[model samples]
Each structure stands twice: as structure tokens, then as C-alpha cells.
Target: MPKGYEMLPNGIIRIKSDNSMYDPWEIKKSQLDGEELTLIGRVVWAEQKM
Candidate 1:
């Protein structure tokens, strides 16, 4: 399966690492207002082998 991180519709970020999942909702909340948010990250695609 492809692994990394993603920002959910609920304003929650799912971080996948070491076969574990972490939800950083609190941090996302603090960084955003309402449904609008600016996410900063480098998205690496597993299929591309980057």
C-alpha cells in the first residue's frame, strides 16, 4: 500500500509512518479557520518511487 500523509475532509491530517497512523487534528485546527486551510508539505508518490 502507498504510505505517507494526507489531509482529510474533516480538517485532520493522517500521518503514516513505521506502519502506524497518527492524527494531528489539533495542530491542523490551530493552523486553519473554518473549512479553508493552507497545507505545506512535499508530497512523494509511492508509484513514482520518489
Candidate 2:
């Protein structure tokens, strides 16, 4: 798992995209371990274009 990303108690991944304005994406825990999902890196800070 990358930085700032967390796994919930119910096996859900709580993650946010580079664009903070958009809603966070919740992925299943099993998906991360599968080939379907790839974790490259995480963005610590982002400046939204207004």
C-alpha cells in the first residue's frame, strides 16, 4: 500500500486520487493482491485547479 492509503476494518481500501476535488476511490482488499490493481506510488500533496 502506498502512503496516505489505508485499509479499512471491513476490507475496503480508502484512497484519494491526485485531484482532491473528486471523490475518493474505495477498492476491495482482495483487488490489491490481484493482478487487476497495480500500486505505482502515492501523491502526498496536490494543488487543485480552480
Candidate 3:
């Protein structure tokens, strides 16, 4: 699950951690602009690769 993903009215996804939106876009719960996006089974790292 995304760190700051929240379900808004009418089913939109809002990523609070994304300080680039500047305005509220298609922020919904469990949905990414009516599309289901996931990072499951994906490898992640806290530090950048050097």
C-alpha cells in the first residue's frame, strides 16, 4: 500500500506524500484514477543505489 494513499469522494486516490499535485486530483480509496495499481512483489529500498 502507498504511504499516503487515501480514498476520496467518488473513488479517487490522493497521495499526500506527493508534494507535486499542488491541487487535489483523482484521489480515491483503493483505486488509481479508476485503475487498480499495485507494487506487490516488487523489491524496494530505503537508500538509493550508488
Each model's backbone clash number:
0, 0, 7
lDDT of 2 by residue, 1-50 (tens): 23346778888887765555657778888866765545567566766989
RMSD of each: 6.9, 6.7, 6.6
Encode model 1's per-residue lDDT on 2-39: one tens digit a residue.
34557677666665544245434334654555565444
Task: TM-score for candidate 3, please give it.
Answer: 0.33
| Best-performing candidate as measured by TM-score | 2
Misplaced by over 4 Å in model 3 are 18-35, 39-50
Model 3, 1-50: lDDT tens digits are 12355666775665543335345345345533456665333235455779
Q: lDDT of candidate 2?
A: 0.66
Ranking by TM-score: 2, 3, 1
TM-score of each: 0.29, 0.45, 0.33
List pairs with backbone clashes in candidate 1: none
Q: Pick the winner on lDDT between candidates 1 and 2.
A: 2
C-alpha lDDT of all candidate models, in order: 0.50, 0.66, 0.49
Give per-residue lDDT, candidate 2, residue 42. Answer: 56
